[model samples]
Target: MDLKLQKFLESTDFIRAVKVTVAAATPVILFSYLNLFSIGFTVALGALFTFSSDIPGNLRHRVNGMLASNLIATGSTVVISLATINPWIFYPVLISLVFFLSMIAVYGQRATLVSFSGLLAMSLSFSHSYTGWALLQHAGLMISGGLFYLCISMIFYYIRPYRYAELRMAECIVLTSKYLKLRGTLWDIRADRNKITEELLSLQIELNETHEKLRETLIKNRTKGGSSNQNRRLLIAHIELVEILELAMATSFDHNKLHHTFQEHPYVLNAYKHLAYNLAALLNELGQSIENRKKYTGKHRPFQDLEAFRKAIDRYEKQTHTSGRPTADEVLVLINMFNYVEKQAEKIKVVEYTFTHALHTQEPKHKDKELEKLLTPVHYNPITITQNLSFSSTIFRHSLRLTLTVLAGFLIGNILPIQNTYWILLTIVVIMRPGYGLTKQRSVHRTIGTLAGGIIAFGIISVVHNSTVLGILAMTCMVLGFSFIQRNYSIGATFITLYVIFVYGMLTPDIQDVILFRIADTLIGTALAFTANHFLWPSWEFLSLPTFLENSIKATRDYIREISVFYNRKGEVPLPYRIARKHAFIEIGNLMASFQRMTQEPKSRQKQLGQYYALVVLNHTLLTSAASMGSFIQSRKTTKASEAFNAITGAIINNLENAMELLKEEKQNIPVDKETKEMLKLRFTELKEIRKKEILESGGTQNENFRLKMEEGQLIIEHLIGLTNLSENIVKAVKDIRERQ
Candidate 1:
């Protein structure tokens, strides 16, 4: 099957869309048959809003979120419906409600979704003509509908508890597969390193998000009684997938440097690239099998490829010795690259084994608090909201911006003599986000989708006026709209517009008026949103870049410290080390996302973009090197921590610390002694000579352990040196940016 089609068919989005559509359609169908279409419409609206909070999670939180959403949406509808009794009462009530509802987003993603439901309810309340007892009954039906949808969610979850987690794991594998293919391209010297770096960082950000959600689903479930055979297997596969990402990240190299040195050794590079491509192919196949719920039958011969790749490097090492070109650094790089590939191959095999064989081996369980730290924190306290009431809070500022923009939109709608004036408020509520870049992007997408949907819906209504056919089309659009909302917002908007038009066509005689008003109101609302976000307290990415960079540096430093300790006491990867690794990746992802957002903003808002880009690249490389060093130490049997190792690692850690300090405009005094630097340089030279001698002596006929020890020492020293240099460069970049500021 085609992968795109397969993704859609097997995706959680598709399943959730089916559930959401059913939740919405059930009430409408039943009530319309009984001639209570208005009540059914209200119920369907309630179900739709409540289902928005049904994000993937453990059973408890998922239910709690939906319950909260139902209560908020129901309460908002009742309050706003009654507040519309007078203009003075309506104005203040609407403004305060929208602001407070938007402010609730400070709690977290689930809260944000729940908050959106309340805001949406309040906005839609403006369209209602009911009053008093009728309004209360409408609210009652809404609560019933929300509860019904909650039951559906619970039923689906209990029927297939691990389905979401399994799908997420499959997604992780697929992302890692794509990442591997991109990583492979780095071996090609002529490839655009800058473009690839940007793409790789973007992919890492997506992977980090997926990994976090999976942690919430899989780890949280296991701790709360989800340790069945299937859960164990999926957990093991998830662990392997994370290790594969680390291994893939570690495989990154300074391609320019490697190309400069190995200009004559293109074949060796091709060998590495080919092996990487094959590994990616294997991962792709593995992900497909996982998605299809089938055991991974071994198909690709990765071992043979590994053997051939290793021999190719060996042949090159021999050639370097005969030529006496002094390319020892480049040769060691090739060896380390080979070692990184070997680690990934071993991890992939473990994942395959976990899938193919009966799962008997149990991975160690994390304590509750430890597992909690892996997932995104959710705050429910009122104090959390109070703390964010200040203007300094981005959410607070966004709330104000949203409130003011909505006020302007409302006034314009009232003055323009347009029917269904609430359409303007609806557009504003849907299009505006906390960040300017996203608001701008969404405004454009909403405008385009509304226009296109209007045109398409107009054509459909022109030819086919049958109400039954239109109802089916509306249901299908609702399904598509829910499915694509998170995956692709523009497409989601298009389908949602189609659904709205079809429904309004059934409700009113003037189908063309509905379509025209929707488009015009969207344009007006999006323009107001865009203008408000730009002129109001816009959350510029540059202002937050320093914190992101500092966090990444600190995480990277802690990770290097863990690696240093492991060098002295080599064993299984400690929980602390894993935590540090996770923090490092997450922070790096945050930084990348910030930089990407900055790129989308106005050029004038892009402060020191070039310097920030340099820092991003150097920081990325620094963390990659740290991961490589840590991975090597954990996987290999090697000598204890040498003094030279301490000297290099100490310098690297100090450099990172200094960079963080520079970001904070604090004085930095850490410095390595001249003698220590000279000693480290001499020690590295001695290690390289020993490694070369071991390789030449082995010549396909010597002690494997001895050769392996020499190789480990050589690679470890090189990684330490490269990391130190990257850290120093990062400090310089930070200093430059600080000076400019």
Candidate 2:
């Protein structure tokens, strides 16, 4: 098989699309052959709704979610079908159901999906005026379809239980390789640092998302029962990926300073860049090997590059010696850079051996109840829904907007002489999201995609008259449409439009009218959704950015505090430290995503743009630097936390706390103590002197072990000083944003 195609086939999304297509289309096709097309179509709808609730998770959650969706969707179909008898009854019932169902999203992601299934059923219920027994028959068929889909899902899980988790891990590994490559490119002398930095930040958000998905898939299963060998291997891979990311972040240095220091010798910097790129390539190859279920046997050895880089550094020192050049600090910086590369290479070696040899690195196992805390907690309590009843809650506001917009769409469809009025409601439901930026984006995509699809569908109908070909085309579109719906909405919408048009074309002789109606109803729906989002309590990103920023800073603080605790007590990294690190990454990713969404919104709605941008960059640096320090401590044997280390970490945490307080509108300037600042400076000076003495004592031929120990001490001091400076800057940046507010 072609590698790309093989990867796609192995993906969880493709598998899901296949399951959905089979579940939905099989019933319709079979029943239609039996001249029971109506029942078949009803069953198809039921299956699709239940499929929507089959989100990624453990077996129990997956089964329970689909079952709940089956019940909810069936109830919705029945209630809406019965109420459609009277306009007065239908409008009130529809409005109340929309509000209640949409508000359930406050419960969590899984609940949101289950709620979406209910709303979808309600929307489709408007398509026909089925009364009494007809409604009961439809509901029954829907349950049958849902049950059919549930059975298929369980069978697939039984056949390949680790498939989803494995794919998720593969994705994270591949993304981490890309991340390493981007981080490596920062060493390029001619690279566009700003653009690369933005890409790195964007990639961080994606990695965080994938990490959460892995947690949902792997952690949930491990918690459920005794984990199988396959599950344990995947869990270990995920843990390594997380730590590898930290190693990548930790390996980063002050590029500006590096560039300035190497201004006269760009070749040395190029050597570093080359080694970094080689490391990335090695990692990428390993990821591919994992994805392909093959052993990675070092097709391209980065160890060679590491050796070459070491040689290059030796030559540079030899040349600089005659020129009376390269000060002591510069030599120390070189050692630091070399140490970073060597450390990363060593870590990658460990990962490779573990993967290829199937070595089970000891991983801590949590009990079911304790492991649940690792996944994003969902509150099933009714109070969670009731608390979001206020307008201040984004979910509540979104629910209200959806209800009112859907009601208006229904009314407009009724007033207009339109066929398939449910299309309008479907459009409204599909286009409107909780946030203005996404809603606006979807409205545009939906409008363009519908028109484009209609034009193409018209041409296809005009040119082709074969029923077999049309059926094939529609089926193909269904598969592609389902595959892209979550991955790429615009492309999904286009294919879905084609699927709809082709299906309806077979039923009606007036294909042109069908096309026109689809286009018109879509336009109406998009307009209503866009208008409602803008004018009806729209959730803007800018207004929420401050809260995100505060959360990011707070999480960063907690993460650093964990490192501080570890500094005094070094051992294997504990679960609390990993949890804190995970939360920090998540919060920073959220802040970055919020800023990105704000950028997409109208300029009038974007506030303090430059300041927000600065904060994003600063927060990223703060987290990365802290990770550098933390990872270094974890990976190596380091001295106990001296008073200087304690003072510096305390200052960093204090700055972070003050930043949060400032975001909360509490103004206070808490500078690093003058004595503590001197302490850091004094420590750095002392390290340089100690390094000088070590070189002299060993007659400039110190054993590698002794040299590494000296370098580690110098590196620790450097990281401490840099972190102290960064944390103080974060304080100033927050104060500046506060003043603007």
Candidate 3:
């Protein structure tokens, strides 16, 4: 069996989805208790709607998000149902509700979900007629039904307060281990660094996301006073795992240096590569063990070659001395590489020891004294609604567009020969989006998904006459659909379509007509959505590329400044630097995502995209090297290297900023300053002289700082080279664009 397949089956989502499936059907199955059987249908509707908002997060945030959705559902169902009693009032009120809901989308994705769920419920409620006390009763029933699901949510929260957090931590461990394997591949001279870097950048983005989640979850489970935490063991283990990854994955190495030494003496690194593989296997084993709350069953002899690799490098230095003049920098490079792998092995042992003991101890001997310093969970606040409330805002335009398109769809549904008019409304709400790229992509998927689902549902309806069996199938489809919505949209849409079709088929039994009408409704809704997407204040990703790129440049600037500050202060890292690093990562991730969406869009819209892509790739490379050195710089003592670092960093930053400004102005042919280039070279030469004298006279077992400074100098040199290359390309990208223009 494939290991990936095994992991997927064991995921927390798979388990939760199975639970949701049972929960969805439980209400309907238990409806046989009372003589009134039809109430089960309404209860099922309430459950399905509530389940739509059951997104993953910390337990408290998850419950709050759902509760907010429930409140919206209750209020919207009652108000929208009452308003629809008069057509004159219904059209304006419904349109206004959709417009306002769409405007709230600027708050964020979750806020968007809560608002859109209300819109969906309101639209569906309009299909039935209710007035006065009957309308209030219908709203009351829906609220009561939603309350039942809320009860389930409460149980879900208490049963496993930290399940999602631990699952994410497990995923982080697994991905980092896999990334280590990818890095091991880079040891081969024939490896494609470009391809590997792309994969690494993607994984880094995912790791960032998981780190963000862990930060939030840790805050939630933290107790106020000096009591033992429910999650202390896991939290401590997670921090250990993070440090292990920093040593394993983010510790910067001179690739050329390694390659150069490897070409001369391959035996030196043979054990190092094997150690990496050993750690990969062990980390993955640890991940699986953590997920299952069991001991690590895998075995490996880690750091077995620590002595051998050291001896091999020692032998190389002696050989170099006999054959020619052996430079201190060169020998130190070999020793540094040797020490890196050794430290990795050591870190792995620490992780292994932590997991083995931290999780099993009856009472923790020590507590997380620094737990107060951890960042709190980021929750959605309504402050954003007030910040950007103008007509100029994208959210307002999207809301206005969504409202107009919905009104048109509603009018057509009333005129057309369709049994389920609300399906059209639901389709539009589901498929249409604020941006052309997203809406067009969703339009294609939704149409394809509906056709495929309608056909399967048609076949099932043709043969499955027993309503109970159909209900079971529909409930199964619904759960699977909801599960895949976050994982895979097209697959989720297919199952969701089938669920909706089956639900309606039990009432409107003409299978052929039902399928035909669904296809027609989907096409109509998709067409209208695409039309509105194109003609409205349609935001294209291409138009937004320059803005995101500019922001990326700004983030890079702040990050470099933070690096300077870290090296300058040579103490505990400031909180502002951490915040800046986060912003840098987030902006780059946004740029990468935007570039990806641009690729998916039509070709004509992607002018200069290739050049922009080159710039993005270069920026990502610089950050990757920067990411490697962020923590390393903090741990180093202030030395003579800091002065040269200060001297050279300014020119590079100035050149990079100038390039950014040139790109923003859409100009070309920015020349590199002769003084900057000369200064860069002169400073590196000075550092080499400072290092060569120290290394030439130093005995073999000196202060660890001596070895650290050697590694740190090399790291700074490599990053400077990267910064020079990327800074040039950032300018050249704009030059390329100018040529095309």
For residue 144, model 3's alpha carbon misses the true position, in angstroms, by: 1.6
What lDDT tens digits, residue by residue, belong to model 1 across residues 1-741? 876787787789888998888988999999899998878888888898899789898778899999999999999988887777787798899889999999989988888999988988877887876697898888888898899899888888889888888888888888999999998887775789789888999999999999988888877778887478887787778878888998878765777877777778787877777778988988888888888877677678788889988999888888977887665556667777788888888888888777778976665664545655666666688999999998768899999999999899989998996787788888889989988899988998888888888999999999988899999999999889878887888898899999999988888889998888888888998899999999999888888788888998898899899889878887777778888899999999999998899999999999999999999999998898888878888777787777767777887787787788777745543354678567667877776776677667665523567556666867776787788678878977887787788
Please provide, for model 2 over 149-246, each residue's C-alpha lDDT reduced to its tens digit, 9 standing for 90 to 100. 99988888889888777667767878988999998877766789889989999999999999998888887778776777777777767777788888
lDDT leaderboard ranking: 1, 2, 3
* Model 1, global lDDT: 0.84
TM-score of each: 0.92, 0.92, 0.88
Provide the global lDDT of candidate 3 against the true structure.
Answer: 0.72
What Cα-based lDDT does every candidate model obtain?
A: 0.84, 0.84, 0.72
Q: For model 1, how many clashes?
A: 0
Candidate 3, residue 727: how far the Cα is off, in Å: 3.7
What does candidate 3's lDDT look like per residue over 1-741, in tens digits? 566676665566665676566655676677756754556656655655665567665556666666677678767777787787677898788887787777667766567877777878877876776778876766666666667777876677678766677678788788878878888888877889888877876776787677667765664455332223447656665666655655554455657667775577777677667777888888888888777666676587676657767777787777777887645667766665665677677776776676676354443334333443455334457776666666556687788888998899989988978777877888899988777788898898888888889888888888888877877888888877876766877788889889877777766667678788888988998999999988887766777787788788788778887877777767777767766776777778778877877877778878778787788887776666665566556544546445677776776677668767776654556776787778778888887777677666666434676667666666667666666666666766756766676
Off-target runs (Cα >4 Å) in candidate 1 are 1-6, 86-89, 254-269, 293-296, 313-334, 363-373, 665-706
- Order the candidate numbers by TM-score, best to worst: 2, 1, 3
- Name the candidate, 2 or 3, with the larger TM-score value: 2
